[model samples]
Target: MNADLIIAGAGPAGLFSAVQAAENNENKKIIILEKNSSAGKKLLISGSGQCNLTHAGDISQFFDHYGENYNFLMGPLYTFDNHQLMKFFKDRGIKFRKARGGKIFPESNKASDILNVLLKEAKARGIKIIYNTPVENVKYKTGRFKIKTADKIYKSKYFLLAAGGKSFPRTGSTGDGFQIASSLGHNIIEPQPALAPVIIKNYQFKMLSGISLKNKEVSLWRKENLIKSWSGDLLLTHQGLSGPGIINYSRYMQKGDIIKVMLLNYSKEELENNLLKKIEREGKLNLLNLLIKFPIAQRLIEKILEIAEIDGSQNAAHLTRQERKEIIEIFSNLEFKIKSLANFNQSMVTKGGIDLSEINPQNMESRIISNFFAAGEVLDIDGDTGGYNLQAAFSTAFLAGSELKERL
Candidate 1:
């Protein structure tokens, strides 16, 4: 064979797997085909260039962050959890610090620091990384695999497809892995934008672009049925809604879905009672001044009043019963109909990938195709923001590498 193993795409998964395989057997010939000019293009831009590598909490807490396929990932994550992943870099002389929400990043606060360390490890292992060579096709017959690139086809005893999903296509993750897996008779879940911003059908919060709320309740609804509810920090964007609260739940969201955001962290009854008491006691106070007493930002409160068709400058005493009820409803339950997600270009990851059932969690190998393995966003696993996705990539890649080592 031209090489013992050929891994497609040099993102975190491919690079990490190559290092793991090489560390196990130094003489094994491993090649990584990276479509980009440099390795880890997406890795360098992750966490806005800081590269949140993993979360700080226990591994058990990670399961719920990954939506549906959480069970399928329990094996890999447990085998190579966050602590081990940290030690891998820490031993390599990279210092790490934990940020808010348990996100772990390099002490240098640079994503290049993370990418450089991975590249350094891969280089030290004698693994060959061919840049600017995209895998055009893959074919397996008679115990050997052929990987077709633009220039020529290369053969290998084992093949790993870690080309990533269709998020951030500019980073060379243009759903090539999904297409290749499909060609191999593997089923692929329809890829959708995950951790993406939501555009409202008639967004009126453009003026509150930078406004944010903390620990606010966010609910997802289809028609009149409540689908899911969670809480996180939210940011009002020029387009619509964003931040961890909305984007993290974007995987479960679709066009025309209604999202209810609690602008004030109080129930409708509580808000009505509180507002009525305030109006009765302070009849001369301006409506805006009364609302400002709540936890919400003044600008957001003004906009909410505007949306409710109530004048912020008007006195609380002047509000009719209907107007008071309308203002209270807006404050308690602000609703937005989702027009669309921000698309793959703006998404942090892809929601769906190769069907998890087709791959063994113990080995990360394709059950349908012998000697073929898959990992990272190429599989049907996408986690919440704040280092979960990267952690999943590392865990799954390590598992694949472990199995490859024994096979070699």
Candidate 2:
């Protein structure tokens, strides 16, 4: 083998993997091949550039954020969990701060600082990283894997495939690794757009194009059937809708499915109770005026009233019980016809990657191809925003680096 280790991609996972290998193994020759001119381009924009490096909490909590199959990360978490990762950064002079929701951002609040630290550490440990060199193919035969770049070919005793997914294409995650993994004996889970925003039905969303709802609950209904619900800040976009709430439900969205939205997020009976209280508290207010309690624009309130058949000019005190009941219904369950999803520009992260079943979770190594490990968004694992994905990248890379070094 020309090199002991050759890691693909230079995002969070690949950079960290190369760093760890170089840091702990002084005797081995480690090389990282990055397609970008510099390392960690996509990483530089994570956490809105503050770079949520890792989470600061129990391993179970970390596992909880990953999804239903938390066990897929048990080995990785134990090997390089948040505590260990934080310590790793601290030792390298990269200070970090704990943000809301267990997220830990760099104290400098510049993702570049995090990337700089990792790159510097790798360079200091005698690791050679070549940039602007895209890997054309990876061919495995005779118990060895061969990697070919544009200008050169290299063979490594061990390989870590950390190329990212197709989200945020400019970040260098183009989903090329998925095809390469499939060419080997791995099965892909049919990658789809995940963590993207939803386009609400034109009827209800057209009026409130720029309004925002904060701390309000949001529910996703598919054809009158409530599929999922999430609550956070909601942003009215130029096209339709976005926000933490809708983005959370995007994981379950399928093609040809229409997702409905409920702005009030109040239960059927709770709707009735809140409506009556509004009438009792402000009897002289008009129906359009009463809707100010919800976080929409007054003009939007008027439009909603028009939809509900409530007289915008009529006094709340004169509202009939039936009118109030209908108003409550509209507020409680505002149907949004889900048209489609926002593209890569609107998404925070990509959902699907390499099928998890094809890789050994313990070391992120491909089961069919010896010494070929996979990590980060390139694998069939993705998490929500607020630093979850960064943590996954770091954890899986840590495991792959350390575990692969053991056999050497």
Best by TM-score: 1
Task: Give the alpha-carbon lDDT of every model.
Answer: 0.91, 0.77
Each prediction's number of clashing residue pairs: 0, 1
lDDT of 2 by residue, 118-212 (tens): 87888788888889988899988787779998889989878888888888888777878887787777888776667787775554656567788
Candidate 2 deviant stretches above 4 angstroms: 203-207, 256-262, 293-299, 320-322
Roughly what TM-score does model 2 have, to 2 decimal places? 0.92
**Residues 1-408 of candidate 1: C-alpha lDDT, one tens digit per residue:** 399999999999999988888886888899999999999999999999989999999999999899988999899999999999999999988899999879999999899988888899888888999999999999989988999999888999899999999999999989999999999999999999999999999888887899888999888999899999999999989999899998888989989999988877778999889888999998799888987988888888877777777898989889899998888778767899999999999999999899999999999999999989998999999899989999999999999998898888
Query: Candidates' TM-scores?
Result: 0.98, 0.92
C-alpha displacement of 239 in model 1, angstroms? Answer: 0.9
Query: Candidate 1 deviates by what RMSD?
Result: 1.1
State in Å the error of residue 16, model 1. Answer: 0.7
